[model samples]
Target chain A: MKVTKKTKVIRSPKRGFYDKETIYKILDNHFICQIAFVYEGYPVIIPTIYGRDNNNLYIHGATVSRMLLELEKGVPLSINITQTDGIVLARSAFHHSLNYQSVTIFGEATLVTSENERYKALKIISDQIIPFRWEEVRLPSKKELKATKILKIPIVEASAKIRKEPPSDEKEDYNLSIWAGEIPITSTIQNPISDPKLKEGIPIPESVKKLMKKE
Target chain B: MKVTKKTKVIRSPKRGFYDKETIYKILDNHFICQIAFVYEGYPVIIPTIYGRDNNNLYIHGATVSRMLLELEKGVPLSINITQTDGIVLARSAFHHSLNYQSVTIFGEATLVTSENERYKALKIISDQIIPFRWEEVRLPSKKELKATKILKIPIVEASAKIRKEPPSDEKEDYNLSIWAGEIPITSTIQNPISDPKLKEGIPIPESVKKLMKKE
Candidate 1:
């Protein structure tokens, strides 16, 4: 990953990471991302699902979606994926902070035009959400595929910013008789709730079972 | 909560909401937000913590932070807050989706100048993270307050988009022998870990105790 002027972590340079391994590790942990693009000379942001392959990130939307339409024009795109790990409590409010891992990517996205590549991108996206479920579910038909538009953004310029340690307070402030600690935050998958219209005899599949076990 | 052209939910119009009660309910649940601003004709996004009052949202950073500096110039700012409730599983890959609640605010922010208002905004932000924490910890001093910059954006042209129901698949696809359900996702606060350098006799504060009980 090339750390261009835009991708460099100007503030708190110590927390910035410009390697592909760190960037991909953070991106692979979360499926949802907030994408920012220029529309009508104003910046617009939208939250959507994304999947990252080797060097490219894929996002899909309906053919008539405004975000996809604007992004397909090869406009500059900024994608952010963040995960809040914990809340850092300090003896002083000025020193409080959060332990989070975030990656920001600055690049342009082009519409995926090839049929074979589109299918591959869609599969990568599905696998990001739930692995091994694509083989169990009914694949998208030609008409369905045509209704969806997929865009690929190369991860050429990106950087990850992370803070994982405890709170750092001023030297004398720590002596104050104030309670200070860390509250860990976690997002876990609960038990699956079956669909109301599900068939009576169908059991939970292996993919979900594996997810439950892993979580 | 006016539905201007910029705030209108173009795609999936049925999921769009234009009410204060609904939008605030979602905003009050999360403390992190993604903010987008145009820089040198390109959109840049940064993830930061935010707090919301009745009709305004407040975000703070170092006085010299790039995001705060750029936003204080009275440029257009876009803020997005999203919470993923669950993953909607369907019998077909085309119908898979996520149950999420998201709000997008389009407005401009001004640097909060008044000392009292700045203190109030900092208290609100600290409350958003942990209730009653502002009273327990050492309040920001005058010099510390001067080092921080707070910006407030009115929630006038904001809209919330939500999807909370089960998967809606094709009529014929539901009959297939495939598992379909919702995997609920939850962000919970675990037990608090005491600071390594904490005072020997200081017990956990009421704020953290209450947060643990509530969560």
Candidate 2:
């Protein structure tokens, strides 16, 4: 929620910024996060799917998740998310970089305990992967709820860094006449090949069908 | 270089001990990392390129990198790298998951100072994009070096979480008629399109040319 720090890199300074709108933009686009926390004396990092609801971020895994168990104990945690836009091929090695937007939220995450919030958190996390599928599928039973743990971390201490544009080079290098620019890259889903054993004549849902039209 | 206290995560009672070698394999294949750290009073995260050398991980950005600067100060830092292999579609929402291999490293980073080590770090970071290009291109000049800051954080505290194969469903759900399985995914680069203004007859380098042949 606060923008206390930002960076200025010469080759890609324009790409770095500290703003809520920019941070939210990047967070909304990515569905996964790498959660880092110290376990014992060493740093432990884990990747998990995450859902952002208002100011709080929710992440969950099996009740037996080692990282989650340690994290649930109120260990300090850092969660990071990123989206790659393209590859920048500068005229020089030093000038080369990737066009990306990333947000990092740092804080100690508490294990969610309220039963109502826990179920809601699970619903939000599931809906993130496939909207409305939660309603279509049978809800979790009491045992299932007890077997899963969801951790909620507030976005109170978060910042965003972004980079976009053609490469930056010294004037002298630019004059040397080497080609330089960005090769835009994107995460594109190919045609959805249905499961071999999919139900006969079951039309692809809108969510699965959505990926097919994207270039 | 030791996988000491600062780099260890709780050994999960279940789904643990896939081995460090297997974890490293996943880390090596990933091209991006989301790093989380505290900046001032807030937590900020960013995504950037990273390379591993022995036990240390090297990352670089502008000399004024905020996260890097905060990280260089030995503050707690969390990093996560993930490779998405496929999408798991199941008969029920609770059983749905992803086929992925991800590693999260948590710990404070130490800035690289030795000229020799920095040189090697730069090479590793660059080679991740194209292996031989480090030799093909010019190295950073003294001024460039002065303008850049590189940090080496040992991958001591780390853990890899992975899920493979079809969905896991309750015994009862298996009997209920519904579809279940994985939808594989991968990142592919299309044929390289040369810059429109590329000078006549500058044969594409072997590295660039070779990428074209990959599907």
Candidate 3:
């Protein structure tokens, strides 16, 4: 992957990573992403779910959604996936920062037109949200698929920025008797709440059981 | 307070909220935000921390930061703050969704030039990350303040979209014996890890201790 001027991290150059391994690692760990595109000379951002498979990223929304309609026109897009790791507490207010891993991709999305490809893309997105659940649950019917629009963006130009270390305070500020450290933050999955209309004897599915075990 | 065309939520109209109370509640709970701005005819998105005070949202960066420099030009900007509450697992893949609260603000940001306002904005940002830590930590000095730039965007044109209920499966799919529910997700603050160079006798600060207590 080439580091284009747009994908390069201008601030904190040292934290910028251009390698595919680093970019994919951050993208695969998070499901939500914010995509930016120019609309009528103004920038617009839409936060939505995304799935990455090999060198392509997929996102699906209702066919009539404004965002999906605009993106399907093959407009230039900037997508960002971020995971906040912790809050860095420094000895001074100026030095406070966050520990995070984020990836930004620059590309244009093309509408997935083929029936087979659309189905595959939808499955990839479903799997990204909950692995193995796509196989367990009912698949999308032709009517449902028709109402959804899927877009695929080639992940050729991307970069990752990461900050994982403890807070670094000014040399003199460290002696100010202030306690400085890192407060780790994590998104944890709690017990599943069954739908009120669920059947009486149905137990938790295997995919959710596996997810709980991982947690 | 007006729902301008830019800030109106076009998708899932029922999920959109225009009330200030709902917007402010979502903004007050989250600090990280993604800001989009048009640069050289292309849209660029940057993820950063922000603080909301009344009708203005403040974000700061190094004086030389590209994002700050570009945004200070008063270009139109779109900022989004999203908090994913859970993953809604439905009986069918097409119905699976995420439970989240997100607020999007469409406006222009101006450079904060006044010395007093700059200092106060920085404190609000710091307090947003960790309350009470601003009082304990060393304040920014003249040079440090000069080295940073802050931009304030009005919160007038904003809307929030939220989804908190359980998954809604199709009428026939609900009887398919598949497990359907929501996996609640929460960003938890873990125990603070003291900096390696911390003084042995210094204890954890009150701000962090209080944050942990709330968790």
Each candidate structure's TM-score, on Cα atoms with residue i matched to residue i, is 0.99, 0.80, 0.98
Worst 10 residues of 3 chain A by lDDT: A3-12
Tens-digit lDDT string for candidate 3 (A38-106): 988889998989888999999999999988889999998999888999999989888899999999888
Query: Model 2 over residues A67-149: C-alpha lDDT tens digits?
Result: 78888877667777777776666657897777677776777778999999999998888766656656656578888788899
lDDT of 3: 0.91
Interface RMSD of each: 0.7, 3.9, 0.8
Candidate 1 residues lying further than 4 Å off, grouped into runs, are: none
List candidate 2 stretches off by more than 4 Å.
Answer: A5-20, A38-42, A63-76, A107-116, A190-203, B1-21, B35-46, B54-56, B62-79, B105-114, B153-159, B190-206
* Candidate with maximal DockQ: 1
TM-score of chain A of each: 0.98, 0.89, 0.97
**Clash pairs detected, candidate 3:** none
- State the lDDT at B196 in candidate 3: 96
